[model samples]
Target chain A: MSATADAAGPGAVRFALEGRITAGTAAPIWKSATDTLVSHPNRPIVVDASKLEYVDDVGIALLFDLTRRERPPEAKVEIRDLAPNLATLIGAYDPKKFVPPAPERAHVGIIEQIGRATERQIEYAQQMLGFLGNCFKAMGLALTRRGVLRWGEVLDVATEAGANAVPIVLLIGFLMGVIIAFEIGLVAQQFGAVIFVVNGVGVAMLRELGPLMTAIVFAGRTGAAFAAQIGTQKVNEEVNAIHTFGLDPVHFLVLPRLVAATLVLPVLAVFADVIGLFGGALVMVGFDIGFVQFYYQLLGAVSMTDFLLGLAKAATFGFALAAIGCQRGLATGAGATSVGLSATSAVVTGIVVIVVIDGIFTVLTS
Target chain B: MTEPSSGTTQMSAVSVRGLRMGYGSRVLLDDASFDVARGEIMVILGGSGCGKSSLMKHMIGLYQPMAGDILIDGESIVQARGEAKAALQRKMGVMYQSGALFGSLNVLENVRFPLDQFTDLSLEQKNLTARMLLEQVEMAYAEGLMPGELSGGMLKRAGIARAMALGADILMLDEPSAGLDPITAANLDRTILSLRENLGFTFVVVTHELQSIFNIADRAIMLDPVSRSIIARGKPSELRDHATDARVRQFFNRQPDAALEQAA
Candidate 1:
C-alpha cells in the first residue's frame, strides 16, 4: 500500500490509498505519510480509495489525523470511488477525536522534596502515637479479663519469630564475643593487663551486645514479616473484614504478635548471653587465662543490675519491633507494591527505634 | 458473527473444550465448553463466585486447568510452552479487573511497553504511536500520569489503550465497567463497539452489568456455579427471552422469580 500526495485537482490535496493498510504495513510509511499530509494545512483531505483492499484501526486513525489537524471547519474532505464495504468500515471512526490534547505536570523542587519528607515523618509519628494508645487499651482489656488472648496464634507467632530465630541469634552473639575478647586482649597484653580484657568483654556482653545483637537480627527477620503479613491483610481488606466482625484489629492481630515477641526475646537473649560467654572464654585461653579464671573474672565484672537491665532491654526491644512492624503494616495504603514498601519501612524504622531506645537507656542509667 | 456457532470450534476465534476449573477440591466449572466466533463481541456472564474470571485466566495461560484445552486462533495455550506459549499469547490482549498496569511506569510508557518489546521501531516513532493510541482511548491528556494517580474510569481507558497498542485481534476485558458511573459505563460500551465495528476486533468480556451486556455483546454464555457448566448460550436477546432454564430466566428477569433459587 502507498499514500502519496498529489495536487492534480483543485478542491483539496488528493492522496490515493492502495492495497492493504494495517498496523504492520502502515508503520513503515506512517511518518512520511503523516508528515506529507500535515504540510497542506489549508486544503482538505481527498482520499482516492479505488484500489483499496483493506484498512485497520491505524489506517482509520491516519484519516482522522488528516481531517482533525490544520484544516479549517469550512474545508471539505471527500472520499471518491470507494467500495461500499470499505466506506462502511471507515465510517465507524469519527474524525473529530484528535482535535487537540497534551499532558501537563508540575515540577517538584529540592526544597519541596525536603518539605514533603518532613511532612511524611510527622504523619508517621502521629500515626504511631495513635497505635500506641490502641495497644495500651487492648492490654488493659486483657489484664481486666474482658478480652481473651488467642493463645494458639500467639504460640504460632512465637514459634516463627522466636524458635526459628535461635541459630542466627546465637551465631551473632558468639562472633561479637570472640571479636571483642580478641581485640581487647591483644591491646592489654603489652601492658601485662590481659586479664582486664576478661572484665571488659564480660561487662559489655551482658549489658549491651547480647540484647542488642539479638534485637537487630529479629528486627530484620520478624519485623519485616509482621509488616508484610499485616500490610497484605490490610491491602486485601482482611482488616476491614475483622472490623465487620466487630473485633478490634489491633487487639486481635497486633497483640498476639506483640505478646509472643516480648515473651520469647528474653529467653533468646539468655541463650545468646551464655553462648557469648563461652565464645569469649574460648578466645581468652590464648591470653593464658584458664577456663575457671575466665569464669571467675566474668562473675566479678558483671552485676545483678546489669543482667536484669539487659533482660528488660531485650523485652522492650522485642515489643518495639513487633509494634513497629504491625504499625507499618496497618499503615498500608493500596496495591501490592505498597505492601512491599511497608515491609521495608518496618525493618528500617524498627532498627532506628531500637538504637534510640538503647541510647535513652544508657542516659537514664548514667 | 461467523454464522452463529452450533457448538463447534471450527470457526471460533477462541474455543474452550472440556474445561475443569476450580481451587483445590472445590469445583466451579466442570467439563465446560464454549466457542467465541471471529470478530464478534462475546460476554461471559455469571453470578458472583462463578468461574467466569477463572475461565478467562485459563484462556490467557495464567491458571492451569484440571482438564481442558483453550485454543487461541488455532494453537492450544494449555499445552504451548516457552516461545510457543508466548507466540500464541501475542495474538490476544487481556485487560484485568483492576487495570493491572505496571506500577512503576507512567501511562504513556505502559502503552508503549508492548511496542518496545515486540517491535524494532525507533523511539520517536513508538512515542508518537503510543500517543495516537492514548488519543483513541480519550486518554492522551493523562499520558504522563501514574497508574496510582488515575481514577477507576481513567485506569480502564488507559488499560484499553495499552491493550490495543499491540493490535491483538482478540481482546479480553474483565469487568470493564464494574465501578463506573452510568455515563462512563455507556461511554466504555461505545468504545468497545467502535473498536469492534471499525477495527474488526473480537472481544471476550466478563461482566454482569445488564446495560453493558446489551450494549456490546453479539453473543453470550452464562455459567451456573450450581451445575458447574454453561447453562445458556446464544445472542443476548435470545438467551434473555427463550432460554428454558429457570436460573437463566431469573438472571435475565432481574427480579426474584418463584421458579429459581438465587445463585449466590
Candidate 2:
C-alpha cells in the first residue's frame, strides 16, 4: 500500500496502516477518511490507504459505503495508493465506484465562469425544446379529456393581451398611419397620384403594420404578464402543487394561456387594421381627398390574400408570445428578482420570436 | 375503477432494490435497498440534504433513479410505461416539505384536485368529498379560505387532507410537521397515527422530528447527511440501541459523535 501511494504522485494523503483491519478496526479508518473530507471542504482530499494493511470484507464494505455518499460539488474526493489485491477487491465490490476528482479552477475566474454559464444557457435552451414537446403533448391530452379549452381563462388573457392593449395598439397604429400618409401623400401629389396614397397605406396596414403592431403590444403586455404570473407561482410552489395533485402542469397551466392567446391576437390585429386605416383616411381628409374615393381605393388595395396573410401572421405572433411567456414563467426561480428577470426576458423573447417568424413568413410567401 | 391484480397480492407497498441516486457527479445515495409492507407506516429520519426527500421523490415517481429500481406494488416505477406510470402515480400521494398547497386554489379546491384529476366524481360530489376530508383534518370551516389565508399549521393540515383525497394506498409525506408549533405538530402526529390505525393505508414519511418518529413510525430509515446515504434502518428503538455507524450514533445521541471528535 505504501509503494502504491508513492506511484500515484505527491497529490495523495498517505496513512500508515499498522495492523490487520478486521471488522472492528475498519470503522475508525472509514471515520477518519470521511471526517477529513468533510472538515477540509473546498480542497482535494486524497486518502492513501498504503502500508502494512490486510483488510477483510467488513473493511471493504465500509470503504464502499463511504464512496456512495454525497459530497459537496466543490469538494474533490479520491482514493489513492491501494494495494493491487485491495484495489481489485474494492473494484469487485462496486465496479462503478471510481469518481475522479474535480479539475482545479472549476469555479475560479469570472470570465471562465461566465463562459460556463453561457454553455449552461445553451444546454438549457436545448432542454427547453424537450419541455415544449412535453407541453404540447400534455395540451393534446388535456384537449381530448376536457373536449374544449377554458374560454374564461382565454378571456382573461385576451383582456390583458388584447383588449387592455387595444388603446396602445390603436394609438400607435393611428400615429403611424397619419405620419406615413402625410409623408407619402405629399410625395404622390407631386406626381398627381394622390389616390395611390390610399392604396399604399391600406395594403401596408392590412398586410404588415396591423399584425406587427398587435404582436408588439402583446409582447409587452401579455408576455410580461405571463412571466410574472408563472414566475410567482414557481417561487410559491403552486406549480409543484399542481404536479402533486396528479395533474400535468403543462396541461393545467400552459394550454389555457396558449388557447387564449391564439384566439385573441388575430382579433386584436383586425382592430389595429381598422384604426390604422381610419387614421390614414383622417389625414387624407385634410388634403381634400374625398372619403368615397379613399374607401374605394383602400378596398381595392387590401385584397383577400392580404387579409388572410395578416390573420395568419396574427395567429403565429399569438403563439410566439404565449410560448415565450409560458416558457419564461416555467423557468422562473424562487425569488422576486427571478420573477422580474423572467418577465423581462419573456417580453424580449416574444418580440424576437414575432419578428423572426414574421420575417420567415414574408420571405416564404413573397 | 381499475382493480388491483390478484397476481400482485404478494407485493410490498413499495420495494427498493440496489437503489442509487445522485445529482450530477455528487452521489447522494448508493446501493440502498429496503421494502415497505402494506399498511405499514415507515418514517425516514435524516438531517438536511441527506437525500431523504430525494428518496421519497423516487419512490413516488417524481424522480427517475440513476441506478436500481423502485417498485410500487411490484411494478418498477423506473421501467413503467405511459398508463402504467400514471396508474402508479394515481396510487400514491405526496405532501411536500412546504405542504405545497396552491395559492390560487382555496382549501376546498386544493383538496378537490386529486378527485378532479383521476376520479369520475361530479363537481358536487368532489366538493362534498373535499369537505369531508377537511372535516377529518379539523378544518371544515377553513374550506373557503385560500392558502394565504391559512396559518402554517392549517396549510399542512389542508395538504394532508388533499393527499388523502384520492384514497391512494401509499402516502408519502416529506417533513409533514415542519414549521408548525409544537402543539400543532404533535396534533398532526396523532392524526397520522390515528389514520394509519383506522384507514389501513400505508405511509412513507420523511421527517426530522424525533417526537413524530417515535410516536408514528412503525419502522424507520435514518440517513447520514455527511455520507448522503442511509446509515441505519430498523425499528426506532433498534436504531437507538444498535446503530454502530458513528454518524448514526451521532444522529441518535444528538450531540457530537465519533466523527466530530475525529475532526476536532
Candidate 3:
C-alpha cells in the first residue's frame, strides 16, 4: 500500500490512498500525511479513496487526522470517489475532532510524589471509614427486617471460605506450634526449667499466634478470592445487573461474604488454638515434660479471659478482612488488570487491617 | 415466504420453546418461543434492560431457563449432561458483548484456543487456520497483539475470529456493532451475509441498531421490557411498516414515549 501526496493547485493538495488502510500499514503513511497536512496549514486537502480496497477504524482515524481542521470548525478535507458506504463513516465524524492531547509531564519531584502518595492514603482511609459506616447501617436494617439478608448465600460462602480452608489452617498452626515449643524448650533446658516451656507455648498459641496466624492465612487465601470474585463480576456488569434490578450490591453481594468470614474465622481460630496446643504438647515431650505436667502448666498460664479475648480478635480481624476485600472489589475499575489489582490490594489491605485491629485489641485488653 | 405449521422439528435449525427467564421475582422473559430456520439470520431486538443479551446467554447455556427448553439441531440443551452438553457446546459459538477475550493470550492464540481444545490438528495447521479466520474478520494484521492492546472494534473482530475457530454451525453475537463505525459496522454486516451465504451458517444476533437490522436480518423478534415477551416478529420491513402495537410501532419508528403521549 502506498500513500502519495501531490500538489493539485496552489492552495490544494491531492492525496491518493491505496491498498489496505488498517493498523498494520497505516504508520509511515500516517506520519508523512500528517506532516504534509500540518505543514500546509488551513489549506484544503483532497483524499482520493478510489484506490482503497479495505479500511478499518485506524484508517478512519488517519483520514480524520489528515483532514482535521483547527478550532472554529472549518471543514478542509474532501474525499473523491469514496464508496457510498464508506461515505457514511466520514459523515459521522467531525473533521475538527481527533486533535492529539498535550503530552503530560514525564517526571515529578520526590517530595511531590511522597506528598501525593500520602494524600491518596488519607483519601483511601476516609472512604474505608465511610464503607464501614454503610456496612453497619445495612446490618442493622437487615436484622430489623425479614427478607434483607440472604442466609443461603452466607452458608455457601462460609463452606467455601471456612470449611474448605480447615486442612491448610490446621497444618500451618500445627507447624507453628511445633516450631515455637521446640525453640522455647531448648532455651528452658539451659535454665533447668523445661516445664515452663509449656506455659510459653500455651499463652502464645491461645492469646497471640492462633488468631493472628489464622487472620494472616485468611488474608492470603479467602480475602484474595473474595476480591477476585466480586471484581470479575463488576468487570462483567453482573454487579450492575444487580443494581438495575433495584438491589443494593452491598446488601446483596458484600453482606453474605462478610457474614461468612466473620462467622468462620473465630471457629477457625479455636481450631488453630486447640491443634497448636496439641502440637506444642507433643514437642514438650522431647524436653522430658510429661503431658500431665504440660496440661496443668497450660491451664495455669492461660485463662478463659485470654481465650475469649483471642476469639474476639479473630472475629474482628475476619470482619475487617472481608470488608477490605469487598471494598477493594467494589472499587475496581475497567479491564482485566484492574481485577488483578483489586485482588492484590485486597490481600495487602486485609492483612494490614488485621494487624492494626489486633494491635488495638491487644492494647485495649491489656 | 410461506409460514409453516410444520416448522421446528425438521425444518428449523434452532427452536426455543416456551422459554421463561427471570432473576428472583423479576421476570425478564416469559413464554418466549421462536424458531430459526436453517441458514437464517435472526435478530433479537430490545431496549436496554429488556434481557436481549440475557436471552442470548440462555441460548448459549450460560444461564438455565426458569422454565421450558431450547433445542439446537433437534437436541434439547436444557437436559443435556456431560459429553452431551459438551457436544452441544461444540455446535454453538458465542461472542459476548464485552468481547471477553482471554487477557493473557495474543489474538492468534485466542483464536486457536478452540481448535487446540477440541481438535487434534497440528500446531502449524491450527496457526494457519487461525490466521485465515482472522483474515476473514480483517484482523490478521493484529495476530501478535494482546487482547488488552486492541481497540474495542478490533477486540470484537478478534472475538468473532475465535468464535468461528470451532466452525460451529450456529454463531451468536451480542452487540457486534456496539463499538464499530458505520463503515466497519456495514462491513461486518456484509461479512455476516457472506459467511451465511457461503457456509450456510445460522446467525442469532442480539443488536438494537436499526441500520444493522435492515442490512442483515432475515427475521427479527422484539422483546418488550414492560410486557416481558416477544412483542413483534417478522421481516424488519414488515414490522416497521405495519406493526399495530404502540410499543412495537414506537420502537420501529424510533418514537419517544412522550411523543406518543402527546399524539394521544
Highest-TM-score candidate: 1
Provide the TM-score for each candidate, comma-separated: 0.82, 0.48, 0.56
Candidate numbers sorted by DockQ from highest down? 1, 3, 2
lDDT of 3 by residue, A1-366 (tens): 788989888878788888765444555677677666777666777888788766543455465555445622332777787765456544645433223332344899999999999999999999999998988888888789988889999999999999998998999899989999999888889999888888888888888899999999999999999899999999878999999999889999899888889999999999999999999999988888788988888888889998998898899988899999999898887679879999999999888788888888888888
Q: What is the C-alpha lDDT profile of model 3 across B122-226, one tens digit per residue?
A: 554456556656766888778888886778888888888888777676899999998799988998998888667544578999999989999999999999888
| DockQ-based class of model 2 | incorrect
Sliding window of 10 residues with minimal summed lDDT for model 3 chain B: B1-10
CA lDDT of each prediction against the hidden true structure: 0.83, 0.75, 0.82
Residue pairs with backbone atoms closer than 3 Å in model 1 (clashes): none
DockQ winner among the candidates?
A: 1
Q: Write the per-residue lDDT of candidate 1 for residues B1-264, one digit (tens) a residue.
A: 111113545468899999998989998899988888888899999898898898899988888899989888877999999999988887788888888888778899999898888765566556666777787677877888888678888888888888887678789999999999998899899988977865678999999998899999998999999889999998888888888887777887776755465543
RMSD of each: 5.0, 23.9, 12.1
Weakest ten-residue segment in model 3 chain A by summed lDDT: A94-103
The better-scoring model by TM-score among 1 and 2 is 1
Candidate 2 fraction of reference contacts recovered: 0.00
